[model samples]
Target: MTSKTLSAFLLNQLNELKDRGLYNTIDPLEGPNGPVIRMKGREFVNLSSNNYLGLATDKRLVDAAVEATIRFGVGSGAVRTINGTLALHVELEEKLAAFKGTEAAVAFQSGFNCNMAAISAVMGEGDAILSDELNHASIIDGCRLTKAKVIRYRHSDMDDLRTKAKEARESGAFGKIMAITDGVFSMDGDVAKLPDIAEIAESYDLITYVDDAHGSGVLGGGAGTVKHFGLSDRIDFQIGTLSKAVGAVGGYVAGTREVVDWLKARSRPFLFSTALPPGTVAACIEAIGILQESKQLQDRLWENAAYLRRGLQALGFSTGHTATPITPCMIGDEEKTQRFSARLYEEGVYAKAIVFPTVPKGTGRVRNMPTAEHTTKMLDRALAAYGKAGWELGLIR
Candidate 1:
């Protein structure tokens, strides 16, 4: 097809998305992502970032980044196999392995890439993977790329997983079986039942994978979800991100030393992509150190989450089945949810609406991420705005 025809076809889809209120507009932030952020020249309470610890702008991490940059210069200069793996990367991997209580760890450029690389590296062609239906987009893509038999279990439904596991095993049509789940469901903020899943995996002799992207630095006093449930030793692949609470950019998979060794030799992304910059690696090490040295931040984060949840409930807003700092205020209609989010932004809160494709068609919501850095006063202001938006939109009586 000609470029013009392709553009016309793409624009038609774009217009359809806009008409349905599902087209997202990027809002550029003028300042750092904090409790209060300036975006598009408007100051608003920022509740949309994954920076749960608010360490993205922390002075200590900044200093660490600066120091590493000065010491190592800009980039690693080549792919990992070709002089790209620096001392900083090695140190960060060691720190992460210790932090997550794993035997060893392997770092990748991003959490999504970690999923893409690790899942496909271990479970290819003839293998079968029983994945959670609501697992992240990255996990879905990883499974597809592997060309594995992807059997989806209902979200956190142990019964469904057991049924699928039984069926897959009885068929005897796979080389290996693996079960994967998000340590915490990002949208609903519900935690995965890791202990139960681990037990099932043990019974089926299936490899276990837990993508704790939303659980690290928030659970187990900062050790992550697997350790929170004392399953670090039980789970095979524990994938996590340095970008969220860790306040840096990259991802890592912690597992048996053999797994790390295998990934080093076989993972396509790790072998081809340039390693993380020295400064970014150093910044992550510092972030992990901070998380380990203190539970004060974690405590404060939970306190803020609890306070926000109570406030939203008091206002009669249905804050779905969330157990973490991720709070989603349910508004069924897509347009109404988008309007609710727009009103929130206008009222000085910067939460974005999530609609179809991200969530089920009729279950749109405005997700709120209350951070440790948000003071009680800031949260109170955000609550007031939510109340106003709720009442104005008739979301609550």
Candidate 2:
């Protein structure tokens, strides 16, 4: 029923991806994506999941989800603007705002959607945005959707951001200017120089927006990067994801009451997309409560990361400038990176190869996400796999 030329075109593109070693074949995980994942009747040390605090499989969180489901049924059944805003949703947003140290917060179905909704809602044509070159795909897409003039500054280079902010302000071509950056860059696991960034924003009067997708539950004692540097009151928009450390499904933009009020009134994704199910919203609230009550989970997570980082570094594998727990084992060649990840999987580690387009070409890596749930024995096994794989591939001496 499909046109042959169109089908051929799709097939050819896929073939090109395969030829260039860019095709990603997703492995089917047989069980929960936890510290150890089961696949095809075998277990592998899971170093790929974003469950940094191990809340994804925590029984308290699971129980909360189940109880909420039983009480509220499966779905919210309508967009947020139309009969979908539940009391639990409001509680989740309130807790999110409190956790992020903002006056108010608004939730979206996914973190990607949060960027799309928040960025475009606040910025539009005739506005100008200064964005970090390495900020995330969602950020790039959000800026593009705004129809705003987006100027890329060198990653974490305060000098470049300063220069761009001055130019953008002095040019007098824009109605408004904003500077956006990730609180934590996931690929290299580097924390943004937020204090410096805040100083620049204040001088130039540039609105600050930080997508703290990788920072929440991992940094600032689980508050986030802005709080980590004591700049919680400086940034205009503080964005985070519940799906990662929160171990639930949703994203939020926490800012002033005006910003949240405006988003609720005008943000397209929030207005059009159906609200997150009751279980996710309730579980997310419970996660925040968990984080607020204790930093024990966060402490355990860091201990695990430090242990693994030391082990990997001792094994002569370069884990790049990671201020957080997300570790990247740099493998320069794309093909070799792919092969390295595959060999590690075969040997019981399940880290995924992150190659070109995801990161710059030739800076491919097998990113490791160490969780609180991982035991020392599991990390040891993963290190042994890395050692054997690196030796076989002539990557490490």
Candidate 3:
């Protein structure tokens, strides 16, 4: 096709996205992604961030990042195999292992990369992965890349998992088997049935993988979902992201020393991509230290979530089955969800509307992530705006 024709086609697709209310425009935050963030010269009660423990703007983490950048220069300069493995990387991995109660740990460029690296390294073609239907996109993509037979169980449905697991094993058609689930479903804010999953994995002799990206800083007093279920020593692979709770950019796989060794040697991202910057590594260490020091932040975060949840329910809005600090205010239609999000923005709250392909089509919601730093007063203000928007849109009486 001619360049002009290709350009026209691309533009048409973009227009279609706009018409569908799925074309998201970037709203640049002028300041740190704190409880209240400055955007376009106005401050909004920032509820869209994954900075669960509010470590993104913590002074200790900031200081550590700055110090590391000054001491180690900027980048790692090459991939881990070449000259990229810095002392900070090793230190961070060790720290993560201790935090997760694992024998060893391997760091990757992103949490998505951790899933991509770990899954393909262990389970591949002729293997099977029994995955939760509501797992993160990263987990889904990782499973797809492995060329493994992806058997998806209904979200947290142990019975369905058992049926699939028994079938995969009885057939003797797979070399290796894994059962994967998110510790917390991001869109719905529901905790996964890790206890049930672990039991099922043991019964099927499946390698247990839990991507605790949302759980790392919010659950088990910030140790993660494995610890939340008291299965820290039972789960095989516990995947976590430093970007979300740690307020840094990277991911890690915490498991047996053997798994860590395999990833270091064979994982494509660790082998091919440059290591995480010194600043981020240092910041992650600082963030973990904060979590280790006290449960103050975690407690405050839950308090804020409960307060916000109660306020939303009082306003006659449905919070669909939330079990964590991640709260979703359910709105039925895509356009209505978009309009609700826009109205929230206009009223100075920064939560975004999650639509189709993220969640299911009709279950679109305005996902609110209330952090440790948000005050009850701020939540009250947000609740007022929500009530106003709900009434205006005829969503609540």
Candidate 4:
């Protein structure tokens, strides 16, 4: 039986969210999350996926997953610390370490869990974590899980970070100090100033952590943002997600052997959660191999991003300072942003609106993710839709 008080509270909160245009409505995709997707029996140009290299639907990945599934069955059957550490998992970790230019790596079920596990496992009471103001939700939650003092600096403000780091270090109030940030800020599509961050970390003797979930397979010829700035050896922890550019479902932390070993021994998620499926591990392995073999896919991804970004700007839409493929068409009002997305849907495009909580209030936008699979024709169609929608909604001329 449902408690009336609980039910009333839920109803009130939901009603308030809906009234404020902050409630998100989810639509199920009827087909694969490719360059074009179908929802509710209608196909639309898919500009809303994290499949940066279009490897999600790649034949090689599909084949690899199928073969592994047939050979190893559907599930791993136990947690990683117990009996679930399959050979495929080990191989995937090896490949990940190699790709990230690290000595060792550990995998987790998802990027969120990886952050939750890694951050909490290492940071605790008497320690402090200096985090970016705009770090991902997972990072924020992970920091919360630990008993550490979390200090948030301005988003990508190196000077603010330096000030906080110096204050934290000089006060001697904390035992260990760590500086953490996202390699790419997804909402605004801006890359983090990793070199500057690294310098500050060195000056303050702070441990460096970079969550490169949106940067892997898109920078440094596909090595990631750490490598993009030639700071792979300097950054202490390199976190990435296989679900995005890798086109699989998992996350990993690549670092020195000691750090990886410590995580494997102490991380709660690694000890309690069931391991990733063999098929998924195999697929991830294959994707890394593909990325290592060539830069063609990365090239295509950049080309498509540039094409879409240029088109949107030509249509008089503001795309925030994006240094990578994640392009956001800035629309300030929450209701108007939602309406613009709906208008795009009506015009056969599937760009989703990002609102408050995901981004700050009054900074709502329709985030467009142009992938390697997006052809010129598809981009043209999307641009046309943006033009019409913008003019009709008084967002553009």
Highest lDDT among the candidates is held by which one?
A: 4
lDDT scores of the candidates, listed in order: 0.93, 0.93, 0.92, 0.95
Model 4, poorest ten-residue lDDT window? 215-224
TM-score of each: 0.99, 0.99, 0.98, 0.99
Q: After superposition, how far is residue 343 of candidate 4 from its true place, in Å?
A: 0.7
Of 2 and 3, the candidate ahead on TM-score is 2
Deviation in angstroms for 296 in model 4? 0.7
TM-score of 1: 0.99
Identify the superior model by lDDT, candidate 2 or candidate 3. Answer: 2
Candidate 4: clashing pairs of residues: none
RMSD to truth, every model: 1.0, 0.8, 1.2, 0.7
Model 1 bad stretches (over 4 Å)? none
Off by over 4 Å in 3: none
lDDT by residue for model 4 (48-128), tens: 999999888999999999999999989999999889999999999999999999999999999989899999999999999
Model 3 C-alpha lDDT versus the unseen true structure:
0.92
List, residue by residue over 279-378, the lDDT tens digit for candidate 3.
Answer: 9999999999889889999999999999999999999999999999999999979999999999999999988999986888898999999999998888
Worst 10-residue lDDT window for candidate 1 reads: 38-47
lDDT of 2 by residue, 1-397 (tens): 9999999999999999999888999889898889999998999999999999988888898999999999998999899988998998999999988888889999999999989999999898999999999999999999989989999999999999999999999999998899999999999999999999999989989999999999999898898999899987899999999999999888999999999999999899999999999999988999999999999989999999999999989999899899789999998999999999999989988999999899999999999999989999999999999999999999999
Number of clashes in model 4? 0
Error of 3 at 152 (Å): 0.9
